[model samples]
Target: MEYYSVDASGYSVKPRGVALPRSVGDVADVVRWAAQNRTPVTARGAGTGLAGGALGDGIILDTSRMDRVRYLDGVVSAGPGARLGAVARLLSGYGRILGPNPSVGPYCSVGGMVATNASGSLSLGYGSIIDNLESVTLVDGRGDVVELPSNRHYSDIISGICRRAGPFPDTTKNSCGYRLDAVPSPDMSHRVVAASEGTLGVVVGARLRTHPAPRRRALAVMRYADARSAAADCPRILECGPVSLEVVGPGIMEGYGGSCVLFAEFHDSVPERGGPDHADRVCGDVRRAAGVRPVMIREGIDRWLAGRNAALSRSLGMTGDRAPSIIEDATVPLERLPDLFDVIRELGERTGSTPVYYGHAGSGNIHVRTPADSRVTEWYLCEVMALGGTITGEHGDGMGRTGFVRRQYGEQNHMLFGLLKDAFDPHHILNPGKILPA
Candidate 1:
């Protein structure tokens, strides 16, 4: 087993054992062992999760090697251990693409993405993992290998869960507690496992839905003189109904203070049938409908897809840096996105610190990376909660945000989360201290 003092960014935490499970049987063995000994286990994937969801004091189950993809009629079965990029590469051969892709694509694991219900710049077009999930197989706290969505007993449990769903946060993208909302629908059973944070059970494998590759593509690079201008145009651009419309504030652009930029991507299923002139007409129509002059439009089917992915991979160069330098994920309602600027700016002023902020403006989900100062970790957490947001949005609350869960979810919600944890893991040995109080 391998251990580290800090994760990707450098957050302070003492990771104990790094267990690499070879298969579902190995996962079950580990769970059984942990249950008997009352040992806690933390599941890890690619170590790319920014929330420290993979951080813990017990054994860390590294699921990176369990990657295996089996394609059925229209669905793909992926091992929880598979890296997201590997899966995407395989799916692309069949003209299929994964739904939600974080900028940190190649490095993240499918399980990690599912754990966080991850969304990306293209999330406006392709929803998160929950939207694409088909089913999941996991080992529950009772040492039972439960196949959700296929078990009638689980359906009854799910129905009961729906009746008791009140104490959870009501939002579009959430990774803070049990995904009870997903379990109510038959198709959403897989979603229940999508963002479980490894606390409810150890995910062995899952089935995912795939989509055909886009045919025609267009981009609208809208430049904003200020953040307000960008915010003002977001709703209008949303009305244009592009496959994906992303916003990156000046904080993300090099040396552009107070300025912001929005990247809009549109997908047309048929491009070979239309000439370049028709493409221009399509882009022009979209621009006119959006009521904003595009600074530039890069046409070409593959070119647009490549550009969107390029923007998503901008976070790959931070290896060997201090841990806390990593980004913290938090999201609010789209209407409250502009207000988040004020909250972050004020928090920085109060804490005497600054953070770089950027994200999927369409969904109001953004990632913030604080300066490399360990002294302000506690303060940054306090401000995040005071602003009526959570410590995690797409990224699950790993060790980094574990200490702040109660405050973010409030007392009532926090207790309900605890109850869900107890129901799933009575002995509290499965990834303890991840999504609930330990």
Candidate 2:
């Protein structure tokens, strides 16, 4: 057991003991041990989670050594401790890939991504972890290995709970609730675990569905006069068929010095018999129709495949010393994105703050980051919710955004979340104070 009073971001939070569990059996044993000792347990992955989901005062079960990969059919069962990048590289050989793509890249574990319901720029096409999850093996508080979505008894229980659940936001990507929406799908049980934040149960392993790698790919660097131009161009660009379409605002340009940038990428498994001229023509049409211009157009098949780290570093500029303290992943309707950008700029004025903005323009999900400080920190949470948006859109409402959950989720949904947390962790011992307010 180990203890820490400081967070990775340097914020202080005291934990009693940190347990490194070497296997799934170890995870179960730890949970039972904690239950018997009347000690709370919080499961931790690589601690790469921006939210304080991994930070708490209790027994921290570090599952880093539980990493392993076992492929069966089109499904890959990876340990909760496995790094996403390592999994991505492993699947590349088989011409398959997972759906969720956090900007933090492959450093985070699959369990962490699932916990947050994470998605990246490619989420425009790939969707989220909820879409990719085939099944999960989680150790419940009673040390029972329950495979969710299966066992009709559990589904019946979940159905009843959801019927009584609160009204959730009508958005594409959300990680706040019990994911009641996921229950109706063929993979309904998978919903119970997605974005649970290790509160409901500790995920020992997960089975993920994969897709064949896209064949031909093209990367386009489009320049906009302002966020409005980028916003206006989103709908038109979608018509051109893009696997990844991301927008970077003035803050990113401040570092890169390109007028409001959009990184557009298209991937198709078909061979490029006629080159990317067709895609380029579509891009040109989108630019012209939207009154924007593209700076560079790059095309490749499987030839120009750089590793995940190279890709993520390029998107999130390397600051060397510290990662940005504030980052946002707010999503809105595609039609509302242009207005959303205007609102964001308006927020900058109100808060006297400027954020580095970028994200999935195709999916209407954008990321914003402000400098970390005490001044104006308190109001930031309210301001984000007032805009009729989520404090988190893709990365999730972990401890970083949990404080703002009630505001974003509203009273009904927020209360439902509390009840769900109570059902999973009646003793309030597992990852206490995460997802739900204390």
* Per-residue lDDT over 153-192 for candidate 2, one digit per residue giving the tens place of the 0 to 100 score: 5566666666765555555677764676566643476676
Write one digit per residue (lDDT tens) for candidate 1, span 283-370: 6755775545785565454454454344323433322233445466676666766777676676567545554556677776666654
Q: Candidate 2 has what TM-score?
A: 0.87
Each model's lDDT: 0.68, 0.69
Residue 30 Cα positional deviation in candidate 2, in Å, after optimal superposition: 1.0
Candidate 2 wrong stretches, greater than 4 Å: 1-10, 185-187, 251-258, 270-289, 299-325, 372-387
Best by lDDT: 2
83 Cα displacement, candidate 1 (Å): 1.5
Task: Give lDDT for model 1.
Answer: 0.68
- True-structure lDDT of candidate 2: 0.69
Model 1: per-residue Cα lDDT at residue 302: 45
What's the residue-level lDDT of 13 in candidate 1? 64
